[model samples]
Every structure is written in C-alpha cells, then in structure tokens.
Target: MNNVALITGASRGIGHHLARHFYDLGYTLILIARHAPALEAFAATRDPARITTLAVDLSNTATAEPLLRQVLSDHARIDVLVNAAGIFRPGSTQTPVDDFSTLLATNVTAIHLLCQLCTPWLLKSAQGRIFNLASISGVQPFGSIASYAASKHALVGYSRSIARELGAQGIKVTTLCPDVVNTDMAEGSGLAADEMLSTEDICRAVDFVMSLSPAAIVEQLTIGRQPRPRQPR
Candidate 1:
C-alpha cells in the first residue's frame, strides 16, 4: 500500500504493537493518543519520518470531523484506519447512570464519528482498510464488564452494518474480537492472565486483515485463550 495508516490509542498496549508491526511492513504511521510522554517514546523507536504521533483524546466526539480534517489535510492521504483507541470502564449492578453516558461516548461514539470522517479519505487510496478492535464479548452476553461489553457488542453490530455499506467502495472493514489479553486493562481485573493472549497476537490478526485480497474479507474473527480453560477442582 502506498498510503499512510492512522492508529488511535497508539501510546501503548495493542496499539503500540500494531504500530510496530505495520511500520516493519513499510506502512506510514499516524499514532494518536492523549499521553505525550508515551507518544514520544513510541516516536523515538518508530522514527518521526515514517511514524507521526498525534496526542489527542478521540473521545471528544464533537471535534472528530475537524480534527480528522486537519490531520488528513496535513498528511495528504489516509489509506487505512486502526480504531484502536478505546475506553473500558467495567460497571456492575451499581453502575452509575452518569458514568454510563461517559463510557458510551468514549467507547462507541468516538469510533462512529471517526469512521464517518475517514470514509472519503479511505476511498481515495487503493488499499483502504478499516480495523475496529472489538471484543469476543461482542458476540456473547458478557456480564462482568457490563458497560464495556455492551458498547463493544453495539460496536460490532455497527461495524458489520457499515461493512455492508462500504464493501462496494473497495474499503474493507474488519472487527477483531479477542478474549482476555495481557494488557494494562487486564492487570487490574484480578483475573489470572495465565496463557492469555498478548497484544502482539491481536496485532498479528490486524496484519493478516491487511494482507487479505480485496475480493475476500475477514469480517469477524474470534480469537481466544490457549488450551481452553479447565474446570474448578
């Protein structure tokens, strides 16, 4: 692909690994996140020439259009988009109504707005690809992380619907749903990450999505734990 890729939530975790993998394959990178220091560290290794970093909170839904416009205008073109940035706030029976709005805005609204603004630019490039980082919970009624799972489930449906609409335009949309991973988010969950998937594993899936022929698309791929889980003693 001769065009550049824009990656959100690229400061670390799955986002960081994806940036590395894509850069190795010669894809120009545009990394976006809110943390300046982490962004800088990523740039140091990825190089400022091939990979450009943007410190922005994509959760600001109202500014998505203008912000994307500026970035695209400066970069000249965007061939691929990795919607890796996400907010996962687990809610329980006591989940507050006020906080639910914030979770929905960050998890669902941001991705929706970015995809809308990214379409025109993506169509311009021959290798236009949209990768949405969804979760296996999207396919099941995952009750533990209530709001997080709900948002992802909705996102999966939204992404699939958009895929049908955009397929003819030569833009491929892929939703990646991986079971628990060894990321910072999982660290605080009190769940044992033994043999859990790594960020690199998911990034590999992203790379595979890019490598597929336009005639075929991996619309939904469910990745999960290794060896499966054993029953309690």
Candidate 2:
C-alpha cells in the first residue's frame, strides 16, 4: 500500500515543495488548499495514480471533513499530515474583530481541528507523524503582523500539548520553527530583505521528522537564522 502523506497549503510555498519531495520518495499525496485550479495544475506535473488534491477552505465546517473523509475512504491509512495552510494578512488589523477571528481560523484553529479529525486514521497508519508549520514568530513578538504571529504562537503551544497527548498512540508531532523562510509568506516583510530560510530547508525538516524511528519523538525543532555577512572590514 502506498503511504499517503496529506499536505495542506499545497498550492504554493513550502507545502508545494514538500509535496514534490514526498512524491519523489514514493509516497502518495493528498494535497489540499483553497485553489482548485492551481492544485489540479500542480498535480498534473506529478504521477497521476499517486497524487490527488482537494481545494478546500478549512474554515468552512462542511468542507473540511467531507474532503478529509473522502481521502480517508480511499487510503487505508494517513501516513503523515503536514498542516502547512496559513494566511499572512499584513495591514492595520485595526478594529475588525472578524479579521482576527478569520486569521486564527485559518492558521491556528484549522490545524488543531484537522489533527482532531485525523487522529483515528493517523493512528491506524501507526508509523504516522504530524508536522505543523510553526514560526520563530511564535517565540518572539513580531512587529507589524501581530495577529498572524499570535496565531502561530498559539499553534506551537497547542502542538506541544497535543504531542504529549498523542505520544502513547505512536504518533509524533513536530512543530517547525524556522526563522524567516524565503517564501511568498516572507516577501514584502522586512525579514524578506534580510537573509531567510528556504522552502527546501523546511521540507528537509519535514523529511527528517518523518524519518525518525518509532521510539524517537522530536517535540520541537527550531531552524535558526543564518549569521549576517560582514559589511565593512
């Protein structure tokens, strides 16, 4: 049976690269994101039998389970789940409470909810591992992207607690805290202008997380920033 690694936010960025990485490693994929056309296009470039996709907005209650259950029905087990779907709304999140709520809904809330729903299937995989795309922003205060940062911060805390809870189930949860990745997420931000992490680097962390022995559980792995180059000698 082909192990299915379900990757959310698969249309772009680290999710996109990770999807390719797993596909090359002979794992079937269930790629999910909000852009159906983009996903269809992306999957076209991969092995047809091993790749499937769902363009779903996790914020919609009706969409999440229907899509996940569909994938579950076809694949006997979910070997891995990478909760990489996130939003970066960088502006004055001034007075709109709904905006903040939506930010949390997409980033923190959806990741938590997906874990809850996928528990049984993941446990059935037995060797399964879960990875959440956390950020260094979680550990430090971000200047302008307050809501986005706070949501990611909450995700790290939530992931820690869940990792403890799921340890007995043979499930490993890893929170990837990479400082300033050079993805669409980093573009336009001050962090982008400075040296940043690469999607390939993050994808490697995901691969490493999945490669661990059943007994080995990595609670948290932080990929630190590169040292700045000297300006003047």
Each prediction's Cα lDDT score? Answer: 0.81, 0.84
Give the lowest summed-lDDT range of ten residues in model 1.
60-69
How well does each candidate superpose onto the true structure, as a TM-score?
0.92, 0.92
Best by lDDT: 2
Report the lDDT tens digits of candidate 2 across residue range 52-140.
88888998756687777777688778889999998877644562678788888988889987898788889998587889988888778
> Against the true structure, candidate 2 has what lDDT?
0.84
Model 1 alpha-carbon drift over 4 Å, by segment: 227-233
Q: How accurate is candidate 1 locally (lDDT)?
A: 0.81
